[model samples]
Every structure is written in structure tokens, then in C-alpha cells.
Target: MSPSAIPPDDILLQVTPALPLPEVWDAIVRPEQLTRWLAPRVRLELREGGPFELFWDPEDPSQNSTQGCTLLRFRDQDEIAFTWKGPPAFDALMNRGTRLTEVQIRVAPCPEGIDVTLEH
Candidate 1:
């Protein structure tokens, strides 16, 4: 299904972080911040069409990672879009790179602080 066709509540995550928009963007793009919240090993190129790989297993990258996937969109302090696949446990479906899903993250200013919306 297309992105627009997906329902707002389906696999959608929203959070109002205390940090500013820039800091929230850092949590989405920075290596150190990524490791703290996301996978242990991450390789993000920070540009459209660049790599946005995340390795859940520290020793073996191929075992569970978004290997060979690329960023669909990248905007500083605004948004990021990247292709993603499941972990090793779902090898049958996840290994099919062409059938992978897209993960999008949008960071915007809000009344309290920064509002981050993630859709997958």
C-alpha cells in the first residue's frame, strides 16, 4: 500500500520530547544518540539516497540489519525517510530487500517542545 493510503493510527508513533527540534533531529540522525535509543550499530549517511543501516547484532551485521538500504529523504531538523527490513527472526520475509518497508520520521516545533512523528 502507498504511504497516503496508510491510516494515521496504524504503526504511527508520536512523541513530544523535551528537547528542541534540533536536538530531537540529532536523536534521529546522530550516531551516539542513535545507539542510545536505536540499535547498537548504525551507519547513516545523512543525505538522500545514502545509507541508513542499523545493525542490531554487534558482531554480525548480515544477521540482522538494514543492510544495502538507502535513505529516501533527508532534511536537517525536519524529516528523514529510509527503507527498513525486519530482524533475523523474520528471515523469510525480511531477507526480501525489495519488499522492505519505509520508515519516516518528522520533527517539528510544538507548544511544549519538539514533536516527533514516526510512521512505518
Candidate 2:
């Protein structure tokens, strides 16, 4: 389905990090950096429309990780938008079908450091 077709009940998360924009960008895009905090394992291609997968519990045989996610858009250190499909329970809660939800991360320079906004 087209990205615009995603439902309206999206989850949003934001934070301000005491770091520069470039650093914040790396923490979001780089697989090595992302696994440190985001997920247990992240496989991503840093390009528009690239495929990505994040495994939160790789060792758990019964858990369904965030599979078939895709990178919808990427703009240097400014913004990154992707698709996210959580486990079955999440799908039930969100009343989602086969279509995946959208997650967007925006980075901007601030007086103190950098402001990061995550919309899912």
C-alpha cells in the first residue's frame, strides 16, 4: 500500500541529545551504532527504498521480529523515514492487516545540541 495510506494512530517519540547532527545521524543510520540501543540486530541499506530488518530478540524462537521493513526515504543528516511492522500482538492492537506502519526520524540542530524526533 502507499505510504499515505498508513493509519492515523501512529506512535511518536522524540529526544534531545547532547551531540552534533552528524553524530545523531550516525546513531540512527549506522547498523553498528543502532544495535547499541535500538535493537538487538539491525540489517539496513542506507538508501531510499532499500530493504531493512530489525531483530529485537534474535535468539527467541517464538518471537516475531520486525521483519520486511523498508527505507522509504533518506536525506543525509536531516531525515530518515521507514516502514515498521511489529509482532503479531502489535498488529492486533493497531488493527493492522498485512500493511506495515511508518516511522520517521528527523534531526535538527539546536542551541544546546541536536533535537531528534521519531514518529512511528
Q: What are the RMSDs of all candidates, in order?
A: 3.1, 4.5
Best prediction by lDDT: 1
What lDDT is obtained when candidate 2 is compared to the true structure? 0.80
Residue 12 alpha-carbon offset, candidate 2, angstroms: 2.4
Cα lDDT tens digits, model 2, 1-120, are 234554566566668999978788999999999899888888899888787778888886136666777899998999899887767767676427767778888899988789888887
- The C-alpha stretches of model 2 lying farther than 4 A from their native spots are 1-8, 60-62
Instruction: Give per-model TM-scores.
Output: 0.84, 0.84
CA RMSD (A), model 1: 3.1
Q: Which candidate should be chosen as best, given TM-score against the real structure?
A: 1
Go through the candidates in order and give each one's C-alpha lDDT.
Answer: 0.83, 0.80
For model 2 the local lDDT of residue 99 reads 74
lDDT of 1 by residue, 11-116 (tens): 7778998887777888899988999999998898988889989988879888788887789998888889998887778868555746777889888898999988
The residue pairs that clash in candidate 1, if any, are none
